[model samples]
Target: MEELILTIVKPLVDYPEDVKILVNEDEGRITYQLSVHKEDMGKVIGKQGRVAKSIRTVVYAAAGSTQQKKVFLEIID
Candidate 1:
């Protein structure tokens, strides 16, 4: 899951090396906290959060066939 998020986000940022993902699991819920270079935040999020929403949708669909845990995405600055 970490690698999946990285693969999706790295190319969208100016500082690919600064992109990071932290995963947390609690009570059957999985949360992916993504952090990128401050300047690249806008790129990852895109206009009106469409990019972020799209990313989350992709991740959700990818995880659909796996365990039935809830998934959450957080883009942190």
Candidate 2:
């Protein structure tokens, strides 16, 4: 999962090394917190959050097929 996120985001950022993800699981849910360099925030999020929404959609679809737990992806600074 982390790899998928990295693959998707790293190319869009100026500071690939700054990209990070934190995983938290509780109550049958898994949350992935994705953080990127501040300068790349706009690129990852895109206009009106479309890119973020698209990323989340892909992550959710991928997780739905392979995991029983509800999965979420959050983009953060």
> Number of the top candidate by lDDT?
2
lDDT of each: 0.91, 0.93
- lDDT by residue (22-75, candidate 1, tens digit) is 889999899999999999999999999999999999888888878589889999
Top candidate, metric TM-score: 2
Error of 2 at 17 (Å): 0.4
lDDT for 30 in candidate 2 is 97
As for candidate 1, its clashing pairs are none
Clashes of 2: 0
TM-scores for the candidates: 0.95, 0.96
- What's the distance in Å from true for residue 45, model 2? 0.5
Q: After superposition on all CA atoms, how large is the RMSD of candidate 1?
A: 0.8
Worst 10 residues of 1 by lDDT: 59-68
TM-score of 2: 0.96
